[model samples]
Target: MDGGVFANLMHGFSVALQPSVLAYAFAGCVIGTLVGMLPGLGPLAGISLLLPATFGLNPIIAIVLLAGVYYGAMYGGSTTSILMRIPGEAASVMTCIDGYAMTQRGRAGPALAIAAIGSFVAGTLSVVALMFLAPTLASFALRFGPPEYTGLLLMGLFVLAYMSGGSMLKTLAMAAVGLLLGMIGIDAMSGYTRFSYDVIELADGIGIVPVAVGLFGLSEILLTAGQPTPPAIQRPTLRQLIPSLEEIKLSVGPISRGSLIGFLIGIIPGSAHIISSFVSYGIERRMSTHPERFGKGAIEGVAGPESANNSAATGAFVPMLALGIPTGPITAVMLAAIMVHGISPGPMLITQQPDLFWGFVASMYVGNVVLLILNLPLVGLFVYLLRIPYSYLYPAILCFCILGVYSVSNSVVDVWIMLGMGAFGYVLRKTGFEPAPIALGLILSPMLELSVRQSLAMSGGSYGIFFERPIAITMFAAAGVLILLGLKPLLFKRKDWREKVGLEDQV
Candidate 1:
C-alpha cells in the first residue's frame, strides 16, 4: 500500500507540475488571495465566480485552480483579521481576536509572519496526511452518523463555551442568539418560515458576511469613532516584521497541534474548516501556560487558529477525493466541477481516476508553496497599511467593508443589517459579552439542528440514540470530560490553590 501510494503521488506530481497546470494554480492563488483579503468575497464566492471560467478547461486543471483558491483564501483572510480587526471570511473570525490585538500592541509584523508561516507548515503537513491517510480517515469520518454529528457538535459547543475566558453564561447566551439568527430562514427540510416575520429579506436568513463585517469591522469603526486620539496605526520596522526566536519557540507547539487538530476535524463535513480554527483556539487556550494572554495578543492564539484554518481547508479534500462526499462549500463546488466533466466521485475514484485524485492531492503541495511565496514578501507591505491616518483609513475600510457586504446579495438591507449588527456588537463589547461565539452559533446552528432533527426522526424522537451509538457516546463522554476540566480552574482559584491542585499557570 505504501509503495502504491508513493507511485500514485509521483504520478500526480507529474500531472500537477505541467506548465499549464502550474500556471492555473498560480493564477488561482493570486485570485484567491485577493478575494479573501477583500471585505465581502470569500474563497467560496471566489470559487463560485471563477467556476464558469473553468467550464472549458480540463476537469483536472479546473480543480487545481479552484483548489488553489480554496486554500489561498485561508492565507489571505488573516491579513484582514490582523490588520483591520475585521474577518475577511468566517474562518478568519477567530483570527481577529488576537491578530488584531497584536496589531494594536505593535506586534502586527510578528502576527502576520507567524500566521503565514504556520499556514504554510500546516498546509504542507495536511497535504502529507491527505496523501497517506485519506482512505483510512475517510472511513473514520463515515462513522459520524446524524447521532454522531449531534454529539460531536454538542461537545464542540460545550468545549468552546467552557474554554472561554469570560462568563460561560454570556458566551452561551451569545451562542443562543446566534442559533436563533441562524434559524431565521425558511426550513430546508420542511418549507416553513420561523422568524422571517413577513420580511422578504429575512426569508433567506442573514448572510454571515454582513453579520461578520458588522460585528467585527463596523463595530470597530464605531468604537474608533468615539476615541479622541485615533492614532493607532504604526509602521513596523524590518526587525519587527521577523518574529523573535522566543516567539518562534512559542509557536512551535501551537502550529504542530493546529495542523493535527485541523486535519482531523476537517474530515467532518459542513463548516468543518471554520470549526477547526475555533477548536484549535480553545485547545491552545486550554494548553497554554499563560491562558490569560489568549485575547491579549498572544502569538499562540494567532498561530494555532491560523494553522488550523489552512490545514482544515487542505484537510477538506480528504472526503471528496476518497469518498465522493464534499466536506465544505468549496469542495462541494469543486466536486460539482468534476461531476460536470462526467467524472464520478466515490470509493472507486482513486482506482478509476487515479490521475484526478492523485494530481489533485499533489497540486496542494505546489499551491501551499506558491501561497507562502506570495504571502511572505507582502507581509511588510500589509503592515504599512496601518501607517495610514486613521481618519482616512477608517472611512476607506468602512466603504470597502460595506461594498463587500452589499456585493454579496446586492441588497441595501444587508448593509443596514451589517450596521445594526455592528452597533449591537459594540454594545456587547461594552457589556463584556463576547460576540465571537455568536458567529460560530450562526454558522453551526443550522447543521446542528438538521443533524438533531434527522437523528430524532430516525429514532422516532427517542433521545437515547445519542447515547446508544458508540461514536455518539464517545463524543458525549468527551464533552463530559471537557466540562470537568473546565471546572478545575474555577474550583482552584485561590492564590495558593494552584500549588495544591497542580493547575499550571503561565507566569
Candidate 2:
C-alpha cells in the first residue's frame, strides 16, 4: 500500500508493456502449452530446455518469459490429463480423477472449460495476493535468523513426508536419499568434500536441472516406452468447451477455497503445489453438498484442484523472489538463472532492484492473460497433441531432456548422470514411490545445511538454540503436530470417507 511500492509497480507495467516483451511472453505461453500437452513433458523440463535461449534477454524479460512458460505449462497439463488420462505433470494427477472421468462420461469440454476459468481466477487472485502481501512477507522474512530458517526447513521436510501421498516410510526414505544426494558436494563452511566419491564431477554437486529433468522427464520417457500403446484421444469441440452457469456456480466456492489452500501451502518450503491440489480436491468433495458425485464427473472436483495447483505455483514464487530461497526445482532453476545474471534475489530486491521486481510482478499479470488467451481457443489443439504416438514423442522428449540437462553446464557427463537417474527414477516409479518429495528434498537440503551452520555460528554451537527462538519453537511444534496427525491413518481414512459422503450430498 506504500506510495513508493505502487509507483515502482506502475513503472514495472511500463516495462512489461513493451511489444517485444509481450511477444516473448506470448511465445513462452505457446511453448509451455505444447510441452504441457505432452504426456512426458512438465514445466521443469520445458523451462530447462528454454533456459539457454533466455540469456540475451533483460532480467525482467527473461524472468517474465520463464514465468509465462511455467504457468502456461500448468494450464496445458490439465488438457492431457483430462482427455487422455495421462497427466503432463505430477501436479495434474488430481485433475485426472475428475477430468478424465468427465471425458469418459462425455463432459470433457465442460471439464476443460472449468479448469481454464479456475486457473484464471486463481492466478489473478494469487498475483493480487502477491501484490498486497509480498512486501510485508519479505519484511517478515528479514527477521528470520538461521535457527528460525533451519527450524522451518525441518518443518517443511516433515510436511513433505505426509503430504506426498505415499507410505510415510517410503516418503521418509526418499527424503533421506534426496538429502544425501544434496550433500554430495564441497562443504560451504569447512570446504571439505563429504560425498564426492573421489570424483571431480561431483565437486560442485549435482546440478538441479539435470537431476530434475532426468528424474521426471527422461524417466517418464522410459516408462512410456515400457507401457502398452494407449488409444488415441479425440479433441472436444469449442462449443463443448464452455461450461453451464450452474456448473460455474458450483465451482466458484471450491476454486476460491482452493486458491486459499494452495497459496498458504506454497509459502512453505516443499512440493506444496502437487500436494495442495490433492488437498483441495479432497476439501471440495468434503464440502460439496453431494460428495458421491465427485468421482463421477463433479465440476467442483476438477475446478478446486486445478485452481489450487496453479495458485500454489504462483505462491511458490513469493519465497523465491522475496527470500532468495528456492522452494522447489522450478523456482530453484529460476533463482539460478537470476544469480547467473549477477543479480541475487532477497528481501531488499524490491527496493534495490525496483525494475526487476516490479516488471516481474506485473509480467505475471501479462502471463496470466497470455495463458488464458492461449488456453481458451487452443484447448482442442492441446487435446490433439495427446494423439501423438508415444514412440515418436519419447524420442523427442528424451532428446530435449538431454539437451536441457546438457545446457546447464554443456557437460556430457551431466547427460550420463541423467541417464542413470532416469533408470533410478523409473525403478522408483515402478515401485510406487513418488519423486516429488525427492525433488523437494534436493532444493531444501542446502538451505537446511546452511541454516544449521549459521544457527550454530550464531549460538556458538549450542544444540538448544533452535528451540529457544519463539518462532523456531512454534514451527517445530507445528511440525511435530503435523507428523503426528499425518500418521493417524484411521483419522485420514475416516476423513477421506467423509469427503466422499459429502460429495454425494452435493449431487
Across 1-507, the per-residue lDDT of candidate 2 in tens digits comes to 346767867988987888988888888889888888787789999999888877777777788888888888889888888888888887888888889889898888899988988998998899888877777778888889888888878887887776665576788788888888899889888899988888788898888888888888888888777588776685777888888899999998989998999998887777777878878887887677787787788888899989998899889888888888777889988887777788978887766777777888888888888788777777766666667788788888888898888887888878988888888999999999877778778777887899998899888989799889998999989899977766676555644232333422321
TM-score of candidate 2 on Cα atoms, chains taken together: 0.94
Q: Which residue pairs collide, candidate 1? A: 289-506
Provide C-alpha RMSD values for all models, in order: 6.4, 2.8
Ten contiguous residues with the weakest lDDT in model 1 = 498-507
**Tens digit per residue, CA lDDT, model 1, 192-252:** 9878889899899876666766776677667665345433454555567799899999999
Compared with the true structure, all predictions reach lDDT values of 0.78, 0.82
Clashes of 2: 13
TM-score of each: 0.68, 0.94
Off by over 4 Å in 2: 1-5, 490-507
